[model samples]
Target: MSSFPDYYALLGVTQSATTEEIRQAYKKESLRTHPDRLTKASSAEKKRATEKFQAVADAYYVLSDPTRRSEYDVLYASQPRRSQDPNASSNFFSQFANMFAGAAGGSGAGAGQPGTPPAGQRPDAEGVFSDVFEELLRPEVERRVSWWAYLGAVCGAGVGFIIANIPGLMLGAVAGNRLGAIRDAKGKSVAAVFNQLGGNQKAEILRALAMKVLGSAF
Candidate 1:
């Protein structure tokens, strides 16, 4: 009968949202609810914004992490439905922490030895990257293609022929195809990928890529 914050709903994203989507939503929501942005607000408004900001941060911390997100998704699916109350927002982190503690205690394992996710349930880097590319880049490629198609149709056959020969269009097509091919390629282990990079390096790479994708979106 325990209640949990619906991280997906809190972030204004669907359950199937990609990591990039989740990250974008988090950035948007966090900025909107940030206390600094509420300097002119009433005391009650600022307090509400703080609570919402914390909730969004917690949601991003969980959902942006592959393993934690998968575990949470499973737990979320098994829970019965309940309307979220204001108190739930304030207590979200503490409640989630307790749930993890209880899980570890019941498993009779140290926190360092968190139990494995169910078979085939673990999120792999390939899948994560695939989702990122598809969510972030595919639409961009399609949009560009559509724009060119429209321009070609409007500018007559000569311009249409020239547009068809544009290198940017071809490069976009190649990039889109390569992204799918790389993501679909098999045999690389997630642990191996992480091991090759320092922790900070991995984080920086992800952050840089996220920024690049987010920048491209607008």
Candidate 2:
């Protein structure tokens, strides 16, 4: 459980570093600490380089965004953090696991009482999922290369699918758009049944719309 790294220190720059300086520092340090460059290093050294690389990425993400950068500039090296409490860590894990399991809809899980999950059980599904999501989604800890590769693959598939079913998709949209004309009780117009789907179905509908919208625009 490491505390947050100093964004300036991680980038090998002073707190007063300008945006250009920060960008240059990230380029330099990222090149040095990249995991690929450490492939020949010992296993421990490789892990250290990976952590360092992640820290540098995190720092750059924070400092590059104007809103977050302003916030960090104001708060950096100035705010006081609570002393690291070993007991708090264990207690937090206990509460977090039960809440997560309940949220995950697992059986036999209580709704997370304070100090619940015993000290012994391995890190629960909740904690691991949260950490993975945080690392993947946090502007400060992006998976730059991996994420772009995934986006490229998905966009490729989307294009292929749109080309294959253009006619059918257009028909569905025409039908959906006409849904507003139908009337229900008390002379009020009820949106066509298709518009009243639950969240999952609504997501499917929006995704279909997105493919069509993008296809036509392009």
Candidate 3:
């Protein structure tokens, strides 16, 4: 056995404990020894609890992964037993600190490397809009528009024109006035209205608006 604290012992689990058992033990130990749980304790007690909590977390991080666990098991088995070293706890903590420092340094280096945009420089608004637009249009583009929709709108307008040419214009003007009043009451812009629509509804509205704009351009 190694002079270092046994991870399994820290978690209160056996060497042959299953992954789920190890996870449960870690969760139980972590909650019990967490610094927050020592709110009423003395300063010394709180500090000790914090250290124990960190150790439990670190142990779980290593033991939960098969590769790391295997490596640790071999290294642990090869070391002198805990009884042989009076300074075993200090030695274990020193090694743990070095391991944590190395991990942090590696993470920082990877995050700051060239060819990757820094966190502050990354595009957010434009990227989100582009993603949303692409997703919304995907189904519409995949499934061709039905001719019946165009035909229905055309026939409805034609019938209205035939029935009362002058009254139809007056009626359209009244409807437009009512819609404007509703929009003003809501205090919502065209973009806000479009955003409130479901995906399919938005796609249809956008397609019609886009076609109207393009048609006027020609």
Candidate 4:
């Protein structure tokens, strides 16, 4: 029998993991395997990371939704055990690739298609994965930078006007935009650092970020 991709194992989660748990697992796995985080890696390593990243995204999308998760759970339960087989890993990924390729309607038809995912299962599979990647890498405070920059410019202008006069408005806008850009850079730096940390360290950082987000929400 062919081996199936173990979504739970891929994300390091249990089959019984809660939705929130699965979400958290995806965040952890996605960050670790993100291709951008492996710029210094060998070509092969980078390719592997990219594939793993896509797989992680696919697993999260499937497991996060109720209906899909239920379906996956059943399939997973029914798949025969091949953990002892050395070929299990390769077989799993082979099927994984084929699954997405089929989703793209096969090689002949999909080859000419632009913006098609390497193993795209659905027309928008790549799009969904992109969204997930963006969400995962986004800085805590910089989630909506465009909106924040606009608001910041307005506020900065108001503050500047009170301090100075006509010239202050223009100065304030430039300053606001500059400050926004700086913060965004800092956020990116933080994410980079987070990516380099050990597993336990990452968990701590993720926990802190989660707490801060939750605190602000309430």
Give the per-residue lDDT of model 3 (tens digit) for 109-161.
12222211222132122122222234343444333333334444455455556
Stretches of candidate 3 above 4 Å error? 83-90, 93-218
Query: What is the Cα-based lDDT of residue 26 in candidate 3?
Result: 59
**Candidate ordering by TM-score (highest first):** 4, 1, 3, 2
Which pairs of residues have clashing backbones in candidate 3? Answer: none
lDDT of 4 by residue, 35-92 (tens): 6544457999977766666667667655666655665577678887624232443455
TM-score of candidate 3 on Cα atoms, chains taken together = 0.41
Instruction: Output the number of the TM-score-best candidate.
Output: 4
Global CA lDDT of candidate 3, please?
Answer: 0.48
Q: Tens-digit lDDT track for model 2 on 7-102?
A: 676677886788778766765565555444343478888677655655555465555445445555564455444222323234333333233332
For model 4, what is the alpha-carbon lDDT of residue 64? Answer: 68
TM-score of 4: 0.48
Measured by lDDT, the strongest candidate is 4
C-alpha TM-score for every candidate = 0.44, 0.36, 0.41, 0.48
List RMSD in Å for every model shown.
Answer: 15.2, 17.5, 20.1, 10.1
Winner of 1 and 4 under TM-score: 4
Candidate models: Cα lDDT each: 0.51, 0.42, 0.48, 0.56
